[model samples]
Target: MNSGVFITFEGPDGAGKTTILSMVANHFKEAMVTREPGGIDIAEQIRKVILNKENTAMDPRTEALLYAAARRQHLIEKVKPALEEGKMVLCDRFVDSSLAYQGYARDLGIDEVWSINQFAIEMLMPQLTIYFDIEPELGLKRINKNKEREINRLDLENLEFHQKVRDGYYLLMERFPDRIARIDASGTVEEVYEQTVKMIKDKLAK
Candidate 1:
């Protein structure tokens, strides 16, 4: 039997989550560093379809379900096996993104989206989640500067929707304070990294 810890990074687009996740994973890259819905081969293909900008006609529910489906495949093909082998699984984004973006931001209702996701993962949840906190406007500004970033179906959402996503994450933080830690992402990268490192050190120590 494997005994490993599962950690996830979460934040709105352009919140520097991917950068932080990369550093965190490097600290233990010998284990595993993965991302949702596309960490594995098959799931990556689904990721392309889901994030394609041409799919402008995609329904909200369809978007949510696609994310869930991709998550399921990633969990089965990558996350689970890593955990079962006692590898450190550091993932960039996970179920919380769905809860915040698709569930609340998309106005799908957290409970409703969660119910659908339950079928996808069989209730497997991340042991620890680091929420990178930043204002929606600032995050969007950052995203816009990165031309290479995928501005797809979800990225086209309005400011109001992004705000709702931030609010939704705050709600989850309050509801699951024990499992989710908030880090101020507005700070300098070094400052943010130090705070995150401290938080992880504390969690691991416990």
Candidate 2:
């Protein structure tokens, strides 16, 4: 059995997941906050290749595999070790991202994507997942407003693709309702943060 609590944050780009996670991290003194595709050195390198805007020719299967690879490295090098030490781990994105972005949105089967992730991480799964729900249009607008953030290849996808990504998340919620919590992401940062903190605290209490 795992010795620590593992929680993951999921959302469409600009759904305020990163910001809210940062604020919530401050509340948990023993919590470790990390993001996928680049939580460690090897994974960070793979992240660059996956997100590079110039790689427009990358295959969907190839993209999915790379993400799984990075996730495996991150788990081995950082996440599992921290969890073994009994730290609360708050991950920015995890296998759910592949299920959404690559599986449903890209027309690859969700089960297919999940199979690969399972091979990568074994049976390890988050105890709780906070999904920031928002309309794709609004989420894209939020992303565009952030001038300092790098525009990755996924950010360049058309609006329809992002909508499908959101739909995919909804489907995953149905599949794992007990594990995923939905929070409205259309409010101010403080409002969203408050909701997130409450959900997390409630989960911990249980």
Candidate 3:
């Protein structure tokens, strides 16, 4: 059996999950820090296609499939090997993203998207998922103000779509309460970072 701890960070766009995750990674220097859809070379290529702003014609189901495909390669090339070596793995996103973005937000059934990911991951689920919660308006506001952040295809989605994504995450939290820890993300960066660090420390202690 694998011995390492697998933790995933998740949130709506501009919920600051990526920034907070980077800080958390610094605290846990020994952990393997990575991101979904772009951890390894093959996955990164797929990520480019999925996130490319020019890919507006991409179908919802196709988007979901591409995410699953990237996830599979990332697991094989990075996550599984690190876990086998007993290293703590902290990932920016994972299957939960596809479930929220493609499944619920895209109007596709969550169960349907989940079934596709099941085949790719084969039950490799994160031991802990830190979900940063924020209002869709605030999240989008932050994204628009951040010049350094890349404007992906998803970022261009309407406010209603983003709200749906947040709602999807809420549903997921209810579905997996035991595994997901929710944190208010509207606070300052330092505040969110502190909460995230504490959450990870608490989990590691367990």
Question: Per-residue alpha-carbon lDDT of model 1 for 1-206, expressed as tens digits?
Answer: 44777888999877998888777666665658888768988889988998888898888899899999999999988888888987778888998998998888888988999998999988778778999999999999989998887676677888998899999999889888999999999998888887877877787788
**Best candidate according to lDDT:** 3
Worst 10 residues of 3 by lDDT: 197-206
Q: What's the TM for model 2?
A: 0.98
Q: What TM-score quantifies how close candidate 3 is to the native fold?
A: 0.99
lDDT against true structure, model 1? 0.86
Rank order (by TM-score, best first)? 3, 2, 1
Candidate 1: pairs in clash: none
Q: Rank the candidates by lDDT, best first.
A: 3, 2, 1
Give lDDT tens digits, candidate 2, residues 1-206: 56999999999998989989888999887899999989999999999999999999999999999999999999989999988998899999999999999999999999999999999999799999999999999989988999987789999999999999999999999999999999999999999999998998899899
Give lDDT tens digits, candidate 3, residues 34-57. 998899999999999999999999
Candidate scoring better on TM-score of 1 and 2: 2
Model 2 error, position 132 (Å): 0.4
Please give the clash total of every predicted structure, in order: 0, 0, 0
Which residue pairs in candidate 3 collide? none
